[model samples]
Target: MAEIQVNEDEVQVGAETASVCPACQALLSDGTIQGKSVLYCTKCRGLLLPIANFLPLVEFLRTLRRPTGSDIQPRDNSDADRHFTCPQCGKSMTGHPYGGPGNVNIDTCESCSVIWLDRNELQRIVMAPDHYPVYSRYDSGGGLRRTN
Candidate 1:
Protein backbone atom coordinates (compact mmCIF):
# COMPACT_ATOMS: atom_id res chain seq x y z
CA MET A 1 0.00 0.00 0.00
CA ALA A 2 1.27 3.43 -0.93
CA GLU A 3 1.67 5.92 1.91
CA ILE A 4 0.37 9.37 1.14
CA GLN A 5 0.81 12.59 3.09
CA VAL A 6 -2.62 14.13 3.64
CA ASN A 7 -2.99 17.85 3.97
CA GLU A 8 -4.65 19.11 7.13
CA ASP A 9 -6.79 21.52 5.21
CA GLU A 10 -8.11 18.87 2.88
CA VAL A 11 -11.73 18.30 3.71
CA GLN A 12 -12.69 15.72 1.13
CA VAL A 13 -11.05 13.29 -1.21
CA GLY A 14 -11.56 14.01 -4.85
CA ALA A 15 -12.25 11.21 -7.29
CA GLU A 16 -8.84 11.76 -8.89
CA THR A 17 -6.85 11.99 -5.64
CA ALA A 18 -5.86 9.21 -3.28
CA SER A 19 -5.95 9.07 0.53
CA VAL A 20 -4.41 7.24 3.44
CA CYS A 21 -6.13 5.05 5.97
CA PRO A 22 -6.35 6.43 9.48
CA ALA A 23 -6.16 3.04 11.12
CA CYS A 24 -3.31 1.29 9.39
CA GLN A 25 -1.83 4.19 7.44
CA ALA A 26 -2.29 2.22 4.24
CA LEU A 27 -3.37 3.58 0.92
CA LEU A 28 -7.11 4.19 0.88
CA SER A 29 -8.83 3.15 -2.30
CA ASP A 30 -12.08 4.69 -3.39
CA GLY A 31 -15.02 2.38 -2.98
CA THR A 32 -18.77 2.34 -2.52
CA ILE A 33 -20.77 1.19 0.43
CA GLN A 34 -24.52 0.87 0.14
CA GLY A 35 -24.19 2.95 -3.04
CA LYS A 36 -22.35 5.74 -1.26
CA SER A 37 -18.76 6.57 -2.07
CA VAL A 38 -16.28 5.67 0.68
CA LEU A 39 -12.57 5.00 1.21
CA TYR A 40 -11.37 1.54 2.00
CA CYS A 41 -8.07 0.29 3.37
CA THR A 42 -6.75 -2.87 1.82
CA LYS A 43 -4.49 -3.74 4.75
CA CYS A 44 -6.97 -3.39 7.59
CA ARG A 45 -10.20 -3.55 5.64
CA GLY A 46 -11.42 -0.47 7.48
CA LEU A 47 -13.71 2.12 5.99
CA LEU A 48 -13.63 5.91 6.05
CA LEU A 49 -17.07 7.37 5.50
CA PRO A 50 -18.00 10.98 5.17
CA ILE A 51 -20.58 12.10 7.69
CA ALA A 52 -22.96 13.14 4.93
CA ASN A 53 -23.31 9.54 3.83
CA PHE A 54 -23.84 8.17 7.34
CA LEU A 55 -27.56 8.69 7.69
CA PRO A 56 -28.32 7.32 4.27
CA LEU A 57 -26.27 4.22 4.87
CA VAL A 58 -27.98 3.60 8.19
CA GLU A 59 -31.38 4.07 6.65
CA PHE A 60 -30.58 1.55 3.95
CA LEU A 61 -29.27 -0.96 6.48
CA ARG A 62 -32.44 -0.58 8.51
CA THR A 63 -34.40 -2.01 5.61
CA LEU A 64 -32.66 -5.34 5.87
CA ARG A 65 -33.70 -8.07 8.29
CA ARG A 66 -31.17 -9.08 10.93
CA PRO A 67 -29.56 -12.43 10.36
CA THR A 68 -30.63 -15.18 12.73
CA GLY A 69 -28.20 -16.35 15.40
CA SER A 70 -25.77 -13.54 14.75
CA ASP A 71 -23.76 -12.81 17.89
CA ILE A 72 -21.65 -9.80 17.08
CA GLN A 73 -20.72 -7.62 20.04
CA PRO A 74 -19.38 -4.10 20.34
CA ARG A 75 -15.84 -3.46 21.42
CA ASP A 76 -15.03 -2.25 24.92
CA ASN A 77 -14.36 1.32 25.99
CA SER A 78 -10.66 0.65 25.63
CA ASP A 79 -11.22 0.55 21.94
CA ALA A 80 -12.40 4.13 22.08
CA ASP A 81 -9.42 5.18 24.13
CA ARG A 82 -7.13 4.58 21.22
CA HIS A 83 -6.40 7.90 19.60
CA PHE A 84 -6.97 8.30 15.88
CA THR A 85 -6.20 11.11 13.49
CA CYS A 86 -8.50 12.04 10.65
CA PRO A 87 -7.00 11.26 7.28
CA GLN A 88 -8.85 14.16 5.74
CA CYS A 89 -8.29 16.96 8.23
CA GLY A 90 -5.11 15.69 9.87
CA LYS A 91 -6.72 16.46 13.23
CA SER A 92 -7.31 14.26 16.19
CA MET A 93 -10.53 12.30 15.91
CA THR A 94 -12.81 11.91 18.89
CA GLY A 95 -14.03 8.46 19.75
CA HIS A 96 -17.52 7.81 20.96
CA PRO A 97 -20.05 5.02 21.10
CA TYR A 98 -22.31 5.06 18.11
CA GLY A 99 -25.75 6.29 19.18
CA GLY A 100 -27.48 2.96 18.46
CA PRO A 101 -27.91 -0.53 19.82
CA GLY A 102 -24.58 -2.00 18.87
CA ASN A 103 -22.57 0.05 21.39
CA VAL A 104 -19.85 0.31 18.81
CA ASN A 105 -17.36 3.08 19.40
CA ILE A 106 -16.38 5.10 16.34
CA ASP A 107 -13.79 7.76 15.69
CA THR A 108 -15.20 11.01 14.40
CA CYS A 109 -13.69 14.25 13.20
CA GLU A 110 -15.99 17.14 14.03
CA SER A 111 -14.02 19.58 11.94
CA CYS A 112 -14.22 17.53 8.76
CA SER A 113 -17.44 15.65 9.49
CA VAL A 114 -15.94 12.25 8.82
CA ILE A 115 -16.08 8.90 10.57
CA TRP A 116 -13.73 5.94 10.85
CA LEU A 117 -15.14 2.48 11.33
CA ASP A 118 -13.16 -0.68 11.74
CA ARG A 119 -14.18 -3.87 10.07
CA ASN A 120 -17.51 -5.36 11.22
CA GLU A 121 -18.64 -2.22 13.04
CA LEU A 122 -21.10 -1.51 10.26
CA GLN A 123 -22.46 -5.04 10.42
CA ARG A 124 -23.09 -4.84 14.15
CA ILE A 125 -24.96 -1.59 13.74
CA VAL A 126 -27.06 -2.99 10.89
CA MET A 127 -28.04 -6.02 12.93
CA ALA A 128 -28.97 -3.98 15.98
CA PRO A 129 -32.40 -4.93 17.37
CA ASP A 130 -33.83 -1.40 17.22
CA HIS A 131 -33.64 0.93 14.30
CA TYR A 132 -31.76 4.20 14.58
CA PRO A 133 -34.13 6.94 13.50
CA VAL A 134 -31.57 9.62 12.73
CA TYR A 135 -33.15 11.13 9.65
CA SER A 136 -36.71 10.42 10.74
CA ARG A 137 -36.55 13.07 13.44
CA TYR A 138 -36.61 15.68 10.70
CA ASP A 139 -39.60 16.62 8.61
CA SER A 140 -39.75 16.23 4.82
CA GLY A 141 -38.80 19.88 4.55
CA GLY A 142 -35.69 19.24 6.69
CA GLY A 143 -37.00 20.90 9.83
CA LEU A 144 -36.59 19.20 13.16
CA ARG A 145 -39.73 17.62 14.60
CA ARG A 146 -40.54 16.23 17.99
CA THR A 147 -40.78 12.46 18.25
CA ASN A 148 -42.95 10.78 20.80
Candidate 2:
Protein backbone atom coordinates (compact mmCIF):
# COMPACT_ATOMS: atom_id res chain seq x y z
CA MET A 1 0.00 0.00 0.00
CA ALA A 2 1.19 3.47 -0.81
CA GLU A 3 1.35 5.47 2.40
CA ILE A 4 1.57 9.17 3.09
CA GLN A 5 2.27 10.47 6.54
CA VAL A 6 -0.82 12.08 8.07
CA ASN A 7 1.09 12.79 11.27
CA GLU A 8 3.48 10.99 13.57
CA ASP A 9 0.81 8.49 14.56
CA GLU A 10 -1.34 8.08 11.43
CA VAL A 11 -0.68 7.34 7.79
CA GLN A 12 -3.02 7.86 4.88
CA VAL A 13 -2.84 5.00 2.42
CA GLY A 14 -3.61 5.01 -1.27
CA ALA A 15 -7.26 5.55 -2.06
CA GLU A 16 -7.54 2.36 -4.07
CA THR A 17 -9.72 0.82 -1.38
CA ALA A 18 -13.50 0.68 -1.57
CA SER A 19 -14.18 0.43 2.17
CA VAL A 20 -16.98 2.79 3.16
CA CYS A 21 -17.70 4.01 6.66
CA PRO A 22 -20.85 2.32 7.89
CA ALA A 23 -21.67 5.02 10.41
CA CYS A 24 -20.93 8.12 8.38
CA GLN A 25 -21.37 6.92 4.80
CA ALA A 26 -17.99 8.43 3.94
CA LEU A 27 -15.10 6.66 2.27
CA LEU A 28 -13.10 4.84 4.88
CA SER A 29 -9.46 5.77 4.82
CA ASP A 30 -6.58 3.42 5.46
CA GLY A 31 -4.47 4.03 8.53
CA THR A 32 -2.31 2.27 11.10
CA ILE A 33 -3.09 2.00 14.80
CA GLN A 34 -0.22 0.68 16.92
CA GLY A 35 1.45 -0.19 13.63
CA LYS A 36 -1.46 -2.33 12.44
CA SER A 37 -3.23 -1.49 9.21
CA VAL A 38 -6.93 -0.63 9.64
CA LEU A 39 -9.60 1.20 7.74
CA TYR A 40 -10.96 4.18 9.66
CA CYS A 41 -13.65 6.77 9.15
CA THR A 42 -12.29 10.28 9.18
CA LYS A 43 -15.73 11.68 9.80
CA CYS A 44 -16.92 9.42 12.58
CA ARG A 45 -13.54 8.10 13.73
CA GLY A 46 -14.87 4.57 13.58
CA LEU A 47 -12.57 1.65 12.89
CA LEU A 48 -12.79 -1.56 10.89
CA LEU A 49 -10.48 -4.36 11.91
CA PRO A 50 -10.25 -7.98 10.92
CA ILE A 51 -11.54 -10.29 13.65
CA ALA A 52 -8.29 -12.26 13.71
CA ASN A 53 -6.29 -9.15 14.51
CA PHE A 54 -8.59 -7.87 17.23
CA LEU A 55 -7.02 -9.59 20.21
CA PRO A 56 -3.47 -9.04 19.09
CA LEU A 57 -4.16 -5.41 18.47
CA VAL A 58 -5.67 -5.06 21.92
CA GLU A 59 -2.65 -6.72 23.49
CA PHE A 60 -0.32 -4.46 21.57
CA LEU A 61 -2.15 -1.38 22.79
CA ARG A 62 -2.17 -2.69 26.34
CA THR A 63 1.61 -2.83 26.41
CA LEU A 64 1.79 0.85 25.63
CA ARG A 65 -0.94 1.91 28.03
CA ARG A 66 -0.40 3.46 31.44
CA PRO A 67 -2.82 2.84 34.26
CA THR A 68 -5.25 5.72 34.59
CA GLY A 69 -6.85 4.69 37.90
CA SER A 70 -10.24 5.04 36.29
CA ASP A 71 -12.98 2.49 36.22
CA ILE A 72 -14.15 0.94 32.97
CA GLN A 73 -17.05 2.96 31.66
CA PRO A 74 -20.46 1.36 31.62
CA ARG A 75 -21.49 -0.37 28.40
CA ASP A 76 -23.76 1.53 26.09
CA ASN A 77 -26.74 -0.76 25.85
CA SER A 78 -28.26 1.55 23.26
CA ASP A 79 -25.54 0.76 20.73
CA ALA A 80 -26.30 -2.92 21.05
CA ASP A 81 -29.51 -2.14 19.24
CA ARG A 82 -27.93 -0.18 16.43
CA HIS A 83 -27.46 -1.85 13.03
CA PHE A 84 -24.73 -1.47 10.47
CA THR A 85 -23.65 -3.13 7.25
CA CYS A 86 -20.21 -4.45 6.52
CA PRO A 87 -18.15 -2.26 4.26
CA GLN A 88 -16.34 -5.28 2.88
CA CYS A 89 -19.07 -7.84 2.22
CA GLY A 90 -22.17 -5.61 2.36
CA LYS A 91 -23.68 -7.96 4.93
CA SER A 92 -25.60 -6.87 8.00
CA MET A 93 -23.27 -6.54 10.96
CA THR A 94 -24.24 -8.11 14.26
CA GLY A 95 -24.20 -5.64 17.10
CA HIS A 96 -23.51 -6.83 20.63
CA PRO A 97 -21.73 -5.90 23.83
CA TYR A 98 -18.13 -7.02 23.56
CA GLY A 99 -17.37 -9.91 25.88
CA GLY A 100 -14.49 -8.00 27.39
CA PRO A 101 -13.70 -5.64 30.28
CA GLY A 102 -14.33 -2.37 28.51
CA ASN A 103 -18.06 -2.90 28.14
CA VAL A 104 -17.81 -1.77 24.56
CA ASN A 105 -20.51 -2.35 22.04
CA ILE A 106 -19.07 -3.82 18.84
CA ASP A 107 -20.37 -4.81 15.46
CA THR A 108 -19.15 -7.93 13.76
CA CYS A 109 -19.61 -9.18 10.26
CA GLU A 110 -19.07 -12.92 10.35
CA SER A 111 -18.92 -13.33 6.62
CA CYS A 112 -16.25 -10.68 6.30
CA SER A 113 -14.45 -11.70 9.48
CA VAL A 114 -14.29 -8.07 10.47
CA ILE A 115 -15.31 -5.86 13.41
CA TRP A 116 -16.53 -2.29 13.63
CA LEU A 117 -15.63 -0.11 16.62
CA ASP A 118 -17.11 3.30 17.15
CA ARG A 119 -15.17 6.38 18.33
CA ASN A 120 -12.99 5.83 21.40
CA GLU A 121 -14.07 2.20 21.73
CA LEU A 122 -10.56 0.98 21.07
CA GLN A 123 -9.13 3.27 23.75
CA ARG A 124 -11.74 2.13 26.24
CA ILE A 125 -10.83 -1.50 25.69
CA VAL A 126 -7.12 -0.91 26.03
CA MET A 127 -7.57 1.13 29.17
CA ALA A 128 -9.94 -1.27 30.93
CA PRO A 129 -8.29 -3.13 33.78
CA ASP A 130 -7.34 -6.75 33.36
CA HIS A 131 -10.25 -9.02 34.19
CA TYR A 132 -9.05 -12.27 32.64
CA PRO A 133 -8.06 -15.13 34.89
CA VAL A 134 -4.44 -15.04 35.98
CA TYR A 135 -2.43 -18.02 37.13
CA SER A 136 0.16 -17.48 39.82
CA ARG A 137 3.15 -19.64 40.60
CA TYR A 138 2.41 -19.05 44.27
CA ASP A 139 -0.84 -20.98 43.92
CA SER A 140 -0.24 -24.74 44.02
CA GLY A 141 -3.64 -25.50 42.48
CA GLY A 142 -2.94 -23.43 39.39
CA GLY A 143 -6.23 -21.76 39.92
CA LEU A 144 -7.23 -18.29 38.81
CA ARG A 145 -6.80 -15.22 41.03
CA ARG A 146 -7.33 -11.49 40.77
CA THR A 147 -4.17 -9.35 40.84
CA ASN A 148 -5.88 -5.99 40.78
Candidate 3:
Protein backbone atom coordinates (compact mmCIF):
# COMPACT_ATOMS: atom_id res chain seq x y z
CA MET A 1 0.00 0.00 0.00
CA ALA A 2 1.25 3.50 -0.86
CA GLU A 3 0.67 6.48 1.41
CA ILE A 4 -0.73 9.70 -0.01
CA GLN A 5 1.53 12.72 0.32
CA VAL A 6 0.53 16.37 0.52
CA ASN A 7 2.58 19.34 -0.55
CA GLU A 8 2.74 22.18 1.97
CA ASP A 9 3.33 24.69 -0.79
CA GLU A 10 0.19 23.60 -2.60
CA VAL A 11 -1.93 24.61 0.37
CA GLN A 12 -3.42 28.05 0.88
CA VAL A 13 -1.86 29.09 4.20
CA GLY A 14 -3.65 32.39 4.80
CA ALA A 15 -7.16 31.28 5.68
CA GLU A 16 -6.11 29.79 9.02
CA THR A 17 -4.02 32.72 10.17
CA ALA A 18 -4.76 33.47 13.83
CA SER A 19 -4.59 37.22 14.21
CA VAL A 20 -5.92 40.16 12.23
CA CYS A 21 -4.11 43.34 11.28
CA PRO A 22 -4.54 46.25 13.65
CA ALA A 23 -4.70 48.91 10.95
CA CYS A 24 -6.79 47.31 8.23
CA GLN A 25 -8.47 44.55 10.26
CA ALA A 26 -7.46 41.75 7.89
CA LEU A 27 -6.40 38.23 8.71
CA LEU A 28 -2.75 37.62 9.63
CA SER A 29 -2.84 33.84 9.96
CA ASP A 30 0.43 32.32 8.72
CA GLY A 31 1.48 31.46 12.22
CA THR A 32 4.13 29.24 13.92
CA ILE A 33 2.86 28.85 17.50
CA GLN A 34 4.86 31.81 18.81
CA GLY A 35 8.37 30.48 19.07
CA LYS A 36 8.69 33.92 17.55
CA SER A 37 6.28 36.49 16.12
CA VAL A 38 5.34 37.50 12.60
CA LEU A 39 3.52 40.79 12.05
CA TYR A 40 2.25 41.35 8.58
CA CYS A 41 -0.26 43.48 6.69
CA THR A 42 -1.84 41.49 3.88
CA LYS A 43 -3.73 44.47 2.48
CA CYS A 44 -0.55 46.58 2.37
CA ARG A 45 1.77 43.61 1.76
CA GLY A 46 3.87 44.49 4.79
CA LEU A 47 5.56 41.67 6.67
CA LEU A 48 7.51 41.70 9.94
CA LEU A 49 9.38 38.61 11.09
CA PRO A 50 11.62 38.20 14.09
CA ILE A 51 15.16 37.04 13.47
CA ALA A 52 16.28 35.22 16.64
CA ASN A 53 15.46 35.04 20.34
CA PHE A 54 14.60 38.40 21.93
CA LEU A 55 16.13 40.49 19.18
CA PRO A 56 15.16 44.09 18.41
CA LEU A 57 12.96 42.98 15.56
CA VAL A 58 9.82 43.28 17.65
CA GLU A 59 10.63 46.93 18.28
CA PHE A 60 11.07 47.38 14.57
CA LEU A 61 7.81 45.56 13.95
CA ARG A 62 5.93 47.84 16.32
CA THR A 63 7.37 50.84 14.53
CA LEU A 64 6.18 49.48 11.20
CA ARG A 65 2.70 50.86 11.87
CA ARG A 66 1.83 53.88 9.71
CA PRO A 67 -1.27 55.85 8.91
CA THR A 68 -3.41 53.95 6.42
CA GLY A 69 -5.51 57.02 5.77
CA SER A 70 -5.32 60.66 6.73
CA ASP A 71 -8.64 60.44 8.56
CA ILE A 72 -11.59 58.12 8.78
CA GLN A 73 -14.56 60.07 7.46
CA PRO A 74 -17.63 60.45 9.60
CA ARG A 75 -20.38 57.82 9.37
CA ASP A 76 -23.73 56.99 10.94
CA ASN A 77 -23.12 55.77 14.49
CA SER A 78 -26.55 54.44 15.27
CA ASP A 79 -24.83 51.11 15.98
CA ALA A 80 -23.47 52.12 19.40
CA ASP A 81 -20.01 53.67 19.18
CA ARG A 82 -18.07 56.24 21.14
CA HIS A 83 -17.28 59.67 19.72
CA PHE A 84 -14.48 62.07 20.41
CA THR A 85 -13.55 65.55 19.25
CA CYS A 86 -10.12 65.43 17.71
CA PRO A 87 -7.64 67.38 19.76
CA GLN A 88 -5.75 68.18 16.62
CA CYS A 89 -8.60 69.22 14.32
CA GLY A 90 -11.65 69.79 16.57
CA LYS A 91 -13.90 67.52 14.49
CA SER A 92 -16.15 64.85 15.86
CA MET A 93 -13.88 61.84 15.74
CA THR A 94 -15.21 58.41 14.85
CA GLY A 95 -13.29 55.65 16.59
CA HIS A 96 -12.52 52.03 15.80
CA PRO A 97 -11.78 49.39 18.37
CA TYR A 98 -8.28 48.00 17.89
CA GLY A 99 -7.28 44.58 19.29
CA GLY A 100 -3.52 44.72 19.02
CA PRO A 101 -1.00 44.98 21.87
CA GLY A 102 -2.43 47.85 23.84
CA ASN A 103 -5.83 47.58 22.20
CA VAL A 104 -5.81 51.15 20.94
CA ASN A 105 -9.04 52.93 20.11
CA ILE A 106 -8.39 55.45 17.34
CA ASP A 107 -10.29 58.11 15.42
CA THR A 108 -9.54 60.56 12.65
CA CYS A 109 -10.50 64.00 11.33
CA GLU A 110 -11.75 64.18 7.77
CA SER A 111 -11.62 67.96 7.48
CA CYS A 112 -7.98 68.41 8.55
CA SER A 113 -6.26 65.14 7.73
CA VAL A 114 -5.38 64.44 11.33
CA ILE A 115 -5.78 61.38 13.56
CA TRP A 116 -7.08 61.17 17.08
CA LEU A 117 -5.62 58.30 19.09
CA ASP A 118 -7.38 57.67 22.36
CA ARG A 119 -5.39 57.03 25.56
CA ASN A 120 -2.54 54.64 24.71
CA GLU A 121 -3.39 54.17 21.06
CA LEU A 122 0.02 55.37 19.94
CA GLN A 123 1.71 52.69 22.03
CA ARG A 124 0.05 50.00 19.95
CA ILE A 125 1.38 51.58 16.75
CA VAL A 126 5.04 51.83 17.82
CA MET A 127 7.08 51.41 20.95
CA ALA A 128 9.42 54.25 20.04
CA PRO A 129 8.99 57.69 21.52
CA ASP A 130 5.46 59.00 21.14
CA HIS A 131 5.80 62.38 19.51
CA TYR A 132 2.85 63.46 17.39
CA PRO A 133 3.02 66.81 15.63
CA VAL A 134 -0.05 68.98 15.39
CA TYR A 135 -0.17 71.90 12.96
CA SER A 136 -2.73 74.57 13.75
CA ARG A 137 -0.79 77.80 13.84
CA TYR A 138 1.27 79.50 11.16
CA ASP A 139 4.49 81.13 12.17
CA SER A 140 6.10 84.26 10.76
CA GLY A 141 7.84 82.41 7.94
CA GLY A 142 5.20 79.68 7.77
CA GLY A 143 7.24 77.26 9.87
CA LEU A 144 5.57 74.78 12.24
CA ARG A 145 6.01 74.52 15.99
CA ARG A 146 4.56 72.48 18.84
CA THR A 147 2.11 74.67 20.72
CA ASN A 148 0.67 74.57 24.22
| Number of backbone collisions per candidate | 0, 0, 2
Q: Mark the regions of model 1 whose C-alpha exceeds 4 Å error after superposition.
A: 1-17, 69-75, 131-148
For candidate 1, write residues 35-129 as lDDT tens digits. Answer: 56778776676778898897777667657645562333434576878888888888999999888666689889999888888866766676665
Candidate 2 lDDT over 1-148, as tens digits, reads: 9754664223344353577898989998877766777888877877898898889888877787777634545566877777898999898999988888777889999998899988678878887778644434343434233445
Query: What is the C-alpha local distance difference test score of each model?
Result: 0.68, 0.75, 0.39
Per-model TM against the reference: 0.68, 0.76, 0.27
In model 2, where is the ten-residue run with the lowest total lDDT? 135-144
Residue pairs in candidate 2 whose N, alpha carbon or C atoms collide under 3 angstroms? none
The true-structure Cα RMSD of candidate 2 reads 8.1
* lDDT-sorted candidate list, best first: 2, 1, 3
